[model samples]
Target: MIAATADAAEPDSARQRELVRLVRQDCGSCHGMTLKGGLGLPLTAEALRDKPFDGLVATVVYGRPGTAMPPWKTMISENEAEWIVRQLMQGFPEEAR
Candidate 1:
């Protein structure tokens, strides 16, 4: 039942594309180029199916301390993080060629 903050507006198309590239390149490094699993756990929709949605967003923003995950708050907004989680849960989009 968790939702993105009221102020967290959906990113514009250009930003969405930028976000897609960021996840595909940066996150993909640890989550695997396919997001199937690597140093980090799989990010496939099935893998994240039962996880708390808000937590996922928080992880993207705050990161898991003591782990390889690093906070991306400096790079992306919370709303953008939410968008990424939604994409991951529904099968992440491929980086635009």
Candidate 2:
């Protein structure tokens, strides 16, 4: 099981690159290009330092009901969501060069 996860949990480089684009563009459409906050809350590393990682995952996967933040579950997997959260907490990354 662990081995399976090790092989399948992480999105591939191409998928990861696409995910980054979606997050920066689609999510950033509301979260702000710099993730500094707009229609949604700020997603900066400092902003998320005190946040609950699990809750962040839930929000990404399940989204907040009655809010503009839509669930990205249809487009991303649990591991991918976790990766996104980790990236957000670590200042995220620059767009694919």
Candidate 3:
């Protein structure tokens, strides 16, 4: 489980760009291209409004066993996961294309 007080280490410009791409493409594959829910639940700001930060991080890190959500801890760092949780909570970034 990730710490509730985990520091948010922002990624660099290039990394940030890649992260956004991953969110829009890889994650979008299951969460829906528009993040409105498909095989996975919606990730819109309204959908994740009540979700706890730590819980979101854990879900990303450990994933939901028995569900389609696979663990992303290997793909992203604790800080990156935290960053993503915050982004989802605040409304995930839009896809430029």
Candidate 1 lDDT, 1-63, residue by residue in tens: 233467868898999999888888889899987899999999999999999999999999999
Most accurate candidate by TM-score: 1
lDDT of 2 by residue, 1-97 (tens): 0112354467789988998898899899999988999999999999999999999998998889999988888778778888899999999998977
For candidate 1, the lDDT comes to 0.89
Q: Model 3 over residues 1-97: C-alpha lDDT tens digits?
A: 4433355658767777788889889999999878898899999999998888899988988899999999987788878887888888888888566
Pairs in clash, predicted candidate 2: none
For model 3, how big is the CA root-mean-square deviation?
3.2
Residue 22, model 2: Cα distance from true site in angstroms? 0.6
**TM-scores, each model vs. reference:** 0.90, 0.89, 0.87
Shift in Å, residue 73, candidate 2:
0.8
What's the CA RMSD for each of the models?
3.8, 3.6, 3.2
lDDT of 2 at 30: 98
- How many backbone clashes are present in model 1? 0
Candidates in order have lDDT scores of: 0.89, 0.87, 0.84
